[model samples]
Target chain A: MSLTKHPSVGEFLAGCEEHVNPYRPARLALCPMAADAEISDVSTSDTAREGDFVILWGSYTQIFGIVLKHGEIANNRFGNFHHDEIIGRHFGSRVRSRRGGLWLALLRPSPEFITQSLTHRTQIVYHADISLLRALLDARPGHIICEAGTGSGSVSASLSRALRPNGKLYTFEFHEERQKQAMADFSTYGVLDVVVSQHRDVCNHGFGEELKGQVHGVFLDLPAPWAAVPHVTKCLVFGGKVVAFSPCVEQVDKTATELRRSGYFDVRMLETLATNWGVKRQDATKKKRRTEGTTGTTAAQEAEEEEPKDVPKTSGTGEQWLSYQMPMRSHTGYLLVATRAPDGD
Target chain B: MKAKPTLGSHVVLRDLEGAQKVFLLSSGANRQELRMGKYSAIPLETLLSCPYGAILRREADGGWQRVRHSIEVAEETVEVQENNQHLAQDNSAQSLSPSEVRDLKQKCSGSEVVEALASNSATFASKTKFAQEKYLKKKAQKHVQQVTLLRPSVMELCETYYKQSRNKVCGLRYDYLSSLLCQADVRSGARFLVLDCAAGLVAGAMAQQLAGLGEIYRLFRGSYPEKGLLELDLSESEKSCVRAIHLEALESSDPWSSEWLRLPEAPGDAEGEAIAPGRAEARLTRITKRHNDFKSLEAKAVDGLIVVAEDADLCAEVLELGLPRLSFGGRVCVFGHHLQPLAALQGAWRAGNFVDVRLTQLFTREFQALPLRTHPFMVADANLCEGFILCGSKVGEAEPQEAAGEDSPTKKQRRS
Candidate 1:
C-alpha cells in the first residue's frame, strides 16, 4: 500500500486519531486536577474531619482519596476524619499529629470521600473486602462492574475508584433511602462521576439484560441471592466474574445451586477476616512490670528483695511495655466467586 | 420421540448457546402450569426420577427461548444428587410388585436393569460418584487459587514496589488510637508517609493550643478520580488515548504535594540525566515519569495538569520522605470529603493536561464502565485500615490536643 498517496483520508485519519472523547453525561464524567493538585495525605493522629478530603490505600498500589461530608463512622474503613491537622494540608506539607507523628501529605481528597463514608442499612462490603474482591476479580481500570444493593455506596465507591473515568457501574438497590444515600455518598467521594444507581430490585424486576452486556464483573449482596442468578446470567459477559457475599451457609448453598444450574462456571465461596495488632517496645520484664505496677506487686518479689514489709516500691521495674491488639473488623461475610460458563459443551 | 412427562420431575431448559431459556417443563409451563394449562406441567422438582429431557427454544426477539427436547423413559431407578453431593445413602432393598419389576426390567437394557437395582438398593452410589468428581474439580480449583495467592516475602513486595516506583511515595492512614507504632526496619529508606484518619478531633485535640500541622503548611488540595466517563460520545479509540494521556499526566505529577517530579540538580554525583541544551530535558523526564505514575483518565471535564508547576517538586519530596518514615502499619488521612473539586481535576486532566497516545482494549466500550487507577507496580490497597481501628474508648480518651499544654510538656514521656 502506498503510505502517503491517500493524503486527504490519511490526514483525516490522523486528525481523528488525535481527537479526544467528548465528555460523557450519563454514567461518567472527567474532572481534571489543578496542575498542582495532590492525591491527599492520610495518617494517624491527624483525623480527617467531616467535609475534609482523604485518600484510600490498597493493594496494587491503588490510591483513592475522598472528602468527608455526611454519614456515620462505620461505613468507610478509613473511619470519618471530621477534624485533624492533616485534613486541609497541601500535597507536600507534612500532616503531623499534635502527638508529633509524621504523615505523607499526598494528593487532595477525592470527590467521593464523603460518599464512601455513608452509612449502610444493609450488610455492606467494607474496605478490606473491596480491595480483596478487586484483586480476586482482576478488575482493571475501564472494566464494567455491577453491584447490587448499593448499601450506602461504599462498595460502589471502591468500584468507582477501580473503574474510574472510562468505567461505569450500574448499581441497584431496592430501598429508595439507601439509593439516595448511596448517590449522595458517591457524589461526596467523587465516584459519582462514573456511577449509576437504580431503584430496581434484581430479584423481582430482573437486571436490565437488554441494556447491559459485556459486564466485566458483578457483586451480589442481597437477601435472596439465588433469585437474582437468572438476571445475573443474562447480564454477565461470557467468562465474566461474579462474587456473592453472604453470611450464612444456606444462602451460599442456594446461590451455588442456582449458579451451577445456570451454568455459571467456576464458582468458589470464600470469606475475608482481618485481625488487629499492637506494636510496642519489647522487653523481657515488660509483662512482669505491667503486672507489678497494675497489681501493686506480690509477696514473692518482696521476699526475694528482702525489703522492709512497709517499704512501698511504687516503681515497677518491669521493662516498659508498649503493645496490645486493638479490636479488628474480623468477620464481614463469606464470598462466593464464580465465572460465567463459556458457550457449547 | 417425546419422552413421557411424569409428575414431580425436575428439569432445566437451555438454548444451543447453553444459556437458560425459560425455565419450563416438557409440558411447556411455569410452576403454576397446573392452574394455567389444560394439563398440569410435570412436577419434576419433587420426583426421584425424571423421564423427559429439558426443552430449548428461540424467539423473534433474537436469542433462544424454551421449547422441549426428546428423552427416553425407563422403569430403571436413577440416583439423584443434591447440593452437588449425594443427598442420601439408603441400602435397603424394598421388593417391587412382580408386575412392576417385570415392567422395569423389560423397559431398560440389561445394564440399566442393573443400574436400577443398584439405585434401589444404594440410592446415592451413582450420584455420589458424580458429586465426588465435582468435588475433586472444586478442590483442584482451590489449590490453583492458593497457588495464585502464594505471596512473596515483604522484601519481594518492596522490590516490586521499587521496580514500579516512578514516584517514590507510599501513603498510609489509619483510625485514631490504634497502636500508632511505625516500624523503621520494615520501611527504612522508603518514603512511607503515614496519616491517622482520626486527625479531625483526635489529632486536633492532641495539638491543643499549638498550631496543628495543617495550619502550619496547607498547600495543595487533593483531587479524587471521578467516575462516569464511559457515557462520553467519543469513539473508543479517542476515549482510550485521552485516558492514557490523562493517566500519564497524573502519574508524572507529584502525588503528595500537588506538584510534578523535578529532575535532581545535574551537578550532583548522584544518578542524574544531563540537562538539555535549551530544554529542561532532565526536568521534563522527571515530569514525564511523574505523569506516567499518576496516570488518570477523565471524560466530561477539560484536560490539564493536576498540580501547579512550582509546587510539583516540593510536593513530591514531602510525599517521598514522609510516607516511608512513618512506621509500618501507620496510616495517612486526608480531610476533605467533597467530590466536586476532585471531579473537576479529573475533567481538566482529560481535556488538556495530557498528550494523546496509542492504546488498545484499555477504554471500556460495550457496557457501563468505571475508571480504575493502574500503577506500574501494583494497585493501592483499597482497604482503608483506619475505619475500624479507633472504635473503642481509647479513641475517646486520647484527646491528645486538649491534653497538650502549649507551654508545658505534661504528656507522659515514654522512653523510646
Candidate 2:
C-alpha cells in the first residue's frame, strides 16, 4: 500500500514502531525521498486570511492556522493542506514552501529560554541585556541559581533552559500578581518543575526562608537593594555569585557600601550601553526623477493606457532603498557583579 | 539650543554681592540641592527641576541645601549671569574632551563652562586628593583597627592599608571599599577582619605620582586585574624602591602560603621583654623601634597582615571573633588554612562590582617576586580627576552602580 493513501496513518505506524523497539526505525528506514516529497510541495502566501494553515516559527511547533472543520483543507496563503500534513512531523521539522524554492523550518530553542518569551509583568531584560548577562554571569547548565523579582519569568526561563535536569531555580517575586503570571508562563513552558516562584519581598524577609545557603548564584532586580543586604547573607553560600541591577548611582553607592560591610570579595560594578548606527551610503544628490503632472490627474489610467510600462529598475529592486540600523530594545537597568567572600571557604 | 545637565559634571557656587562673585564650592552641585547653597533647608529636588542654570546661592546648611528655582534676591545684592551664549556657540562642536562634554550636556549644557571651571585641573587635583584622603580615613577609622564591636576577616582589615596606599595612587580606594560594602548579595551586619597579603607601602614621592591619576583607586589598580597590577608596577618603579621591591617579591611568590621567606627575630626590647608571642605584642614594640625592622618586613598588604612564624607548624591565634562581629558581607576573607574552616560560609552573598586587585613587588634586585591575595573591597570615589583610594572592607559591603552617568533616556538621546 502507498504511504500517500492516508496522512495520520504514517504517524501511527512510526509511533507504534518506536514504542515497540525504539531503535528499529533507524535500521529499517526505506525511502528518504518520500519524506521530502510531501514537504517540498508545501507553500505559503504573503497575506494571511482566516481559516488558513499558517506556520509560526519560534520556540515550539504546532500546526497553526484557523481550525474550520475536521477534514476540510484550510485555505491559506500557502496551498490548501489538511491536518494530515502535520500528523507525522516532529515539532522541530521544516516543510517546503509552495514556491518550491524557499524553505521554512521550526526553531528549537536553546535551554537558555530567557531570550524568547513573553513577560507577564515587571520589565524583563531585553534581548541585548540577556545576552550580556549570560556572558557576565558565566551562565551554564546544571548551575543552581536564585533570582529576585521574577518579572514575567523571562530570565528564569532562560536560566532554566541552561540548567541541567538536576538543577533548579529559586525565584522570588513580591507582587502576587506577577508571581502568578510567572508561574503560569513557567507551567506553559513545562519548566515549572525546575523553577519555584515565591511571592515574598527580598527587602522585607531576606533570602532566608526560601533559599537558605543552597543557592550557587543570585540575581536581584530591585529598588532599594541595600535594605536586603542583611537578608542576602543568610541565603548566599561562601564563594557564591551575586549580581544586582540598579538604575541610579545613588542606589549603587548604598548597595556597594552594604557589600563591603558584608565582605564579598572581588566586587566590581560597571555599565554597558552600546549604540548601533546605520551604515548606508549618504549620496545627498541621489534623488528620484521628478514626475511632472503626476499628482492629481490620471496617473493610474495613464499607466494603464501606457500598456503597463515595466521599468527595468523597479522601486523594490532600486539602489535608493532605506537602510536602517536600529538600536536593540533600549534601556535596561545597569548591572553590578560581586562575589561572596572567597576566603571564607 | 538649551543645554542639559550631564552626569558627573562639576558646578561652581558663587555668592553675589554687587556681582563681585567668588566661587563657594568647586565641586559639582549636589543633584538634590541644585540651588540650595544659600538656605538652611533648600530642597535640591526643587532646585534640580529649575529651568535656569544661574540662581541665587543659599547660605544655610540644613535641608536639601539646593533649590531648583532661585528666589529673586534683592536687586542690589544679587545678579545672575549665565554663560549660555558660549555653550550655544559650541553646540555639537568638537572640543578637547568631547566625551566629558557629552556627560555635562545632559543636565546643563549651557552651564558647561561653569562645570569645567569647577572641575578645572587645579580644583579636581586638589579636591580629588582631599576626597580620597577623607574617604580612606573614614573607612580606615570605621573598619581598620577601630573597635567595630565585630570583625569580618584579617584580609578585610589588611585591605584597608593596601587600599589606603593604593588609593593614594588611585583616587578613591576607600570609596571603592565603601561601595563594595553595600552590594546586594552580601549579608547585612556581617563583620570581618581582613588580612591583606599584598606587601607595599605608600611613600611621599609615590603620592606625588598618585596626584596625576583621576582617582586614588585608579592610581593603585586599573579597571582590570592585569591593568591595575601593571600600573602599580610602573608607578612604583619611579616612586619608592624600598617598598616597591618588597611588593614585587610578594607578587611573584605564592601569596597564600607561609613558605616564601622569613625575617630574623628583632633584638631584645629596652624594657627587657622576651620576643616570644604571648609576647609578640611586646616584640612588635621593639621591632617598630628600629626603622629597618619594618623595612625588611617587605611588601605587606592588608591581605598579608597576618604575621606567620617561620615554622609552618606554629599556630598563631589570629582573627578570633564571632561571625556577627567579624562578618562583612556575611563572609570573611581567610587565607591558608583559614579558608578551610569557613567552608560552611560558601555560597552566594550580595556583592557588586568587585575587581581583584593584584600587586607585584621586588624585594631584591635579583629576586623579584609576586604574592597573591584577594582584597574584597569596592570603589566609592566618583571624582575622575587624580588617582585616589578610599577604604577597604572589614565587616561591610559596598555596592557600585553603573558607571555611565545619566539616568534619563531623553537626555541620553540628546547627548548622542
Task: Please name the candidate that would achieve the greatest DockQ relative to the true structure.
Answer: 1
Task: For candidate 1, give the docking quality class from DockQ.
Answer: incorrect
Who wins the TM-score comparison?
1
For residues A13-58, could you state the per-residue lDDT of candidate 2 as single tens digits?
2322111110111221221222112211221111222332223221
Show where candidate 2 strays beyond 4 Å. A1-55, A58-87, A90-105, A110-119, A274-323, A328-330, B1-130, B133-416
Against the true structure, candidate 2 has what lDDT? 0.35
**lDDT tens per residue, model 1, B1-416:** 11333333322322222222122233444453421112123333422132222232222222222332211111113544345353443534334555765686445433344444444543334444444343334432322111010112111122222233312112112111111111010010011122212212122111111111111111223432111112111223222222122222233335434434334545433444354434555566656654554332111111111111123233333333332222212223222122222222222211211111001000000110101211122235433222222110001111245335431211121111
Cα lDDT tens digits, model 1, A231-338, are: 887787665678887876667766766776677644565555544333233243422322343266575774443322332221233222222344556457666776
lDDT of 2 at A177: 84
Interface Cα RMSD of candidate 1: 23.4
- DockQ scores for all the models shown? 0.05, 0.01
